[model samples]
Target: MIATRDAYGEALAKLGEENDNIVVLDADLSGSTKTSLFAKKFPERFFNMGIAEANMIGTAAGLAAAGKIPFASTFAIFAVGRAWEQVRQSVAYPKANVKIVATHSGITVGEDGGSHQSVEDIAIMRAVPNMTVIVPADGIETALAVKAAADFKGPVYVRLGRNKVPTIFDDTYKFEIGKGVMLRPGTDITFIGTGLMTAQALVAADLLQAEGISARVIHIATIKPLDEEIILAAARETGAIVTAEEHSIIGGLGGAVSELLSEKCPTKLKRVGIKDRFGLSGKGDELLKYFGLLPENLVEAAKEILAEK
Candidate 1:
């Protein structure tokens, strides 16, 4: 089973045990956010803010100012939208050591539907000057990103999927903020994705491989302050690009890549994601399939994109 929730939980638990400076705060969502591990291990350092996301961000900012590495937990919407002002003024402006750990992000929140979905979180968070935005592909990387965020000095928004996802990379792979991982290399076309879409991109690559199409898949783990070198290289290597994501195509991974590639290589690109619409209540996979973000969807987009060559 592919699951990043437990990975984040275990990572926070380890951080709390090893670093005295680490503090965890949740919007009374300890169980759902998987922050119960930190609360259980370090009860004194854990704060259950009782659904006040703005207060949680403010408190986390305060904790950071006091030399504590605070990780505030909430649904992605609350973290970016509800607490946006505090994040901008208190954390990003001052460059505080506050980590906003948002679980249940994107349409992956499933039955929660349009209300809980965080489709615009990336566009919103990425606009912050000092904010570092990260969307790990799976459980293992989420764990690593958690540790890496602890090392970062300023504000961070670590966007995580709600469900279990395949562990595509082993421990041998190293992770660093502002760096993207290039998985499959191809000269024909490039498939770039982040979070759950990366897994789908891997599957799409396998399918495309069988059809005599070479597709390079890259995981954009760090969204904001994107690795332009890797992106521009992909555009230079492959003439066309296909970007998939569990977010709106307007301002998420696709928009970011397009913005970079436009100024650089100016390649042919197509984005597969929520097409300017909110999601409905259903199973996660159902919503993903409905939004055309599945492997099959990427395969079709890839084939259509490569046909231009």
Candidate 2:
């Protein structure tokens, strides 16, 4: 197991060695955000912008305009909340090649309380017209996603967790922007998930399989340009769908899937996520359970949705 933030740091450092145009900016959280690793390797290419996330974003946009691939690092809350206007106007609006790699996202930013944990980052980032939102499930996927984001142009938002999560993908796995991968195949129900919840969905599928329920697991790393074709196919085949995420059910992965299925397919669905509430100060695992983001919660949601189907 490894933290996605750690993988991001390593990937950034490696990308630095490979690409000269790749530059990094951080909002005084080099250590926590893990951008410090890249800073250590490429001090000249890294700029520690201090606690000013807004300024950091603006600087990144400027660098991007100067024909550089600038990666801005900060916590999800500060990146999306504190520097939202700058991100919208300076980066997304102009389609700048700025990668807003925000770490310590979701309730996994445990012990920091509601102010630090950012459950709405995905939704807000996804809402941006030109922004590409990605939430990698594990370390391997995070590394691959970081590389993919660097190769791709325009504005990008990569959400990462603080705690060490189970490695869901191996070295052989491929990462693509705006694509969803089916990890497990089934027919009775479909569990579409993003971020760390994708790993949990896999576990939920296992538990359901033992009980004679064939649950399909689909991991959607990209939330903005959702894989509608795969999702619509799952809905048509399974007749029921459950979306799990370590975010609010309001406008995150759940909302995206719900909107897609409602207009296109109209499938029986249950969204397993934070119920439009602030995060509490506690351990990461405890927060997940408290917010009903556990495998058991997903399994329960699956059964409920399946019964309706």
Best by TM-score: 2
Q: Clashing pairs in model 2? A: none
Candidate 1 local lDDT, 56-164, one digit each (tens): 9999999999999999998898999999999999999999999999999988799988999989898889888999999998888988999999998889999987888
- Window of ten residues with lowest summed lDDT in model 2: 300-309
- Please report the TM-score between candidate 2 and the true structure: 0.99
Report lDDT (Cα) of residue 40, candidate 1.
Answer: 94
Residue pairs of candidate 1 with colliding backbone atoms: 2-164, 2-165, 3-164, 3-165
lDDT values for all models: 0.91, 0.94
lDDT for model 2, please: 0.94
**Candidate 2 per-residue lDDT over residues 6-75, each given as its tens digit:** 9999999999999999999998999988999999999999999988999999999999999999999999
User: Positional deviation of 255 in candidate 1, in angstroms?
Assistant: 0.9
TM-score, one value per model: 0.98, 0.99
lDDT of 1 at 71: 95
